[model samples]
Target: MSQPQPERGHMMPRRTFNRWVQNPVLEDYALRYAPKSFRRWSEWTVMNSALGGIAYMADFAIGGSVALTYGFANAITSILVVAAIIFLTGIPIAYYSAKYNIDMDLLTRGAGFGYYGSTLTSLVYASFTFIYFSLEGSVMAQALQEFFHIPLAIGYLICSLIVIPLVMFGMTALSKLQVITQPVWLVLMLGPFIAIAFKDPSAFSHWVQFGGASASGSHFSSLEFGLAAGVTLSLIAQIGEQVDYLRFMPNLSTQNRSKWWLAVMFAGPGWVILGAIKQLGGSLLASWIAPAMGSKAADEPIKMYTQAFHTVIGSGYAALALATFFVLLSQIKINVTNAYSGSLSWSNFFSRIFHSHPGRIVWLFLNVGIALGLMEAGVFGFLNTVLGFYSNLAVAWIGAVVSDLVINKGLLKISPSYIEFKRGHLYNFNPVGFGSMIIAAGVSIAAFFGAFGAVLQAYSPFLSIALAFVLAPVIALVTRGKYYIARENAFEKSDRHHEIHKHSELPNEIICASCEFEYEKVDMLYCPFHKAPICSLCCSLESQCHDMCKAEQSTH
Candidate 1:
């Protein structure tokens, strides 16, 4: 409990959050909606920040690893197939998130999961953050070791600790950091590839013919393709990170509709397109260097790019310098995003269960600390093994949410038209999304561990997606959508405007009695226990009241 207790018989005391929590600009509305007032960033600004996270070099490592294991054909096919799936599913989720101005965890609560049901998803999303953070940080550590002769262990510490201050400022600082670095990142990333192509045109043809060590030997095997796709599918949770920034997009209107769609489409699902390209590029570079470096070391991004840069630079030291700088820039750009999003998910998860929040900044440190531990534990060594196992749960979670968004809400019309994230208005658990995710994750995990035969084991993540997608709608129908909304919203009018317009029929701003801070109407709700308007974060932390508002509303 970060909040201090109020005197007995007194109204809920105004919370005294530390400086970080008190400033919405730094906090970035973690654990709640991004209000209309706070969401003032231009469409391109938000999109750039969201897309900046894709600068991570792990895609190169994963691509190189997959190519070495499955040969060129299977690796290329699997990467493209998974990218297409990620893009199609990202459409509805991105649109709804931007329109409603809520992050993935809050979106999950209203989409199919209930108030407390999304706590599980918060954990899932948090895992994606730290896992990727460690991967990216490991790349940066390798660069430090190569350039400065720093020990790998100390390099990991330096890389992990440096991003804390950058992410502590949240979106406000990140947006500027991303915009400033985007051009330099682009030039550095593309320079080596161009140099390699120009230095020896024959290298491209040789790369295409590379069979590596795979049994298939440059040919496609269904089993190998499935296995490669499973590893790539682990990136499915990346949509959550994209929407964390997308939630701050300005409201769409006739004047900005075209720009808004372009921004969302490019920044949201569009990230996978570039990601797939990077993976292919990594695969190509691995092939070029494999004869000299050996396939065992081919998956390292630093090694792959260093060879590419050497084709043009000619000087070994100069090539290494350029490659090291590129790696450091890419790692920092992505890790800050990873740390920021992880803090939001952790804040959502812990605030719901423990009914306490020291601040988003506190959780930021916790997320980075966990990632640092993973880096020290050598998580990078088990990259494919870890991502392969994780893809099952990640696909299951995303599949359930996508089903709820496209099928249940859009096609079936069983769920609400708008997202409702307030604690007092939702059930603690909704079997539709939560149950589907659990069943899907459990079965797929069993299959992944060889509970099923070899073919099923290879395609376990795909199986998770299919089962969760089909099961979500079935559970929603069986429950008759009753769990979606526990009661009528107590904070807004019940007219057509309220249902149709996302933020209509509410005051422009209302002061939260608990925090005593004025917030946009959408983030505040009526609290019968306190008999005042309470913001969502404060309502989530008010354990003493025990949800009297929902109980009282049911009697009426």
Candidate 2:
């Protein structure tokens, strides 16, 4: 028995937007697999781009907010703990995603969650992009308000729209932007800290004891530490953004193994090392500037850096200019990543459900549009509440993915060693990842609302991690790893013909039956309906195919 072929006359022409959406730089394989030929960038270039998105100013605001709400001792302790966990969990996810040359959505799919099950995480990731974009844009608008007296409302529009052009072309545009600004961003970000230390020799000593409006500000409290960590933990999902570029990393090899590991470690989990420092800096700067700028204003990065620079520059106008410039540059650098990742997530989310992709660029505009709406609605004011609630979902999502990767796959060896993410060959849902995330998120979110107790509410994120870690393997064991892979790779013959695609295979191109264009075999699959090989892009857009090939296989 063999798979059936569709009647020749019934085959419909391939309807794909590849012409518009498949710009190597813009689409970057948002809706399909990133084959060997497309991943041509050097390790340094991809690493820099991943690292560039880490310049987001929200960390400053988050750092200051947590310290103000909780105390410096608690905030600092929680920050350290969260950073450690984020780094540890990020390593395997980053390594696997980079090695497979797939984005986070695809990684999640093969990490235990099935094709459609990954959509929940994709939406969660999409929401994160828009939420953080709005926050960073708000920070930029605050700078506009301070420097040009632009109304916050109008400035929000300008800040939100400005990054659209920069992000339109995807990694090609963003990588260059990140590299060019890397040096300047570093100077501005670090210059203020050095200037503050030199100008006020006692700044550190005083900051250590600053009360920050909270009675426990200068000292640690377990309750406050848990609470602070819960809010900061919302950022755990940021690894997905880093993965968006790291997926572009050139394949690891014996020659580049050291550099590959370095790039993955630094750009992946390593972003948090610098992020935590900026947070602490923000907390310290907030205290130093509070009396002059007012408590609420001190938490703003624009104000924190302005006061820090005022001492060194010795002029209010000059300091304001420097702060405004830094804010705009930092915001642009990060928002581009936010938008790019959002587009990828949205493309995955919609393409799966709707079975259509207008283009990754279309989703880019939609993502920015949603973020702009949230910004205009003053979502910035509820940052704490929003982040606290969001942490439950984010922690559960990341926790489940990490559990499957580290425990189910690594320790138990129940799931496949390699990611198997093609939709044509993956189950619609997998209980191992899906069920664990649901239980974890449900219980954690319930606790967050005080359904359990005040103590439970404070430690909801930890509970989510614990539950996810415990449940993932239990579920995998119970399910017998049946859903980890739907079937053997469709392209492989007898499991012996499986090919590990290499960049050197660029000249070995397959012709897309409908498009009449050549592409790497990695992106082409046999189309039984057309009785010829078709590119994945065309396979995706062929609404008329109706899984004829898979159905035919089932009957055999």
Residue 506's lDDT within candidate 1 is 34
Cα RMSD (Å) between model 1 and the true structure? 3.3
The TM-score measured for candidate 1 stands at: 0.96
> lDDT tens digits, residues 1-556, model 1?
1122223344544687888887887788998888766777899999999999899999999999898888899999999999999999899889989888889999999888899999999999999999999999999999898889999999989998999999988998999999999999998888888887778888789877778777989988999899999999999999999999999998777678899999999998999999999999988888888889998788889998888888878899998998999999999999999999999999999999999988899999999999999999999989889999999999999999999999999999998877888898888899989999999999999999999999999999999999999999999999999898876665565532134343333336667778877776677777777776778888899988887877776787
Residue clash pairs of candidate 1: none
Compose the digit string of candidate 2's lDDT tens values, residues 1-556.
1223324444555454556575677777896667676777899999999999989899999998887778678888889999999999899999988887789998998888897899999999999999999999999999999999999999999998899888878888889999999999999999988988788968788778876766665887787888889988999999999999888888776688899999999999999999999889888888787767777787899998888889889999999999899999999999999999999999999988887888888899999999999999998888788998999999898999999999988999998877777666667799999889999999999999999999999999999988987899999999999888655554554332123533333435667776656665455567777877677667656667677776776676
Show model 1 residue runs off by greater than 4 Å: 1-10, 495-507, 553-556
Residue 255 of model 2: what lDDT?
A: 80
lDDT of each: 0.88, 0.85
Q: In candidate 1, how many Å is residue 413 off?
A: 0.3
C-alpha lDDT of residue 450 in model 2: 96
Lowest-sum lDDT 10-residue window in model 2: 494-503
Q: Which candidate achieves the best lDDT against the true structure?
A: 1
Off by over 4 Å in 2: 1-10, 493-508, 514-517, 527-532, 544-556
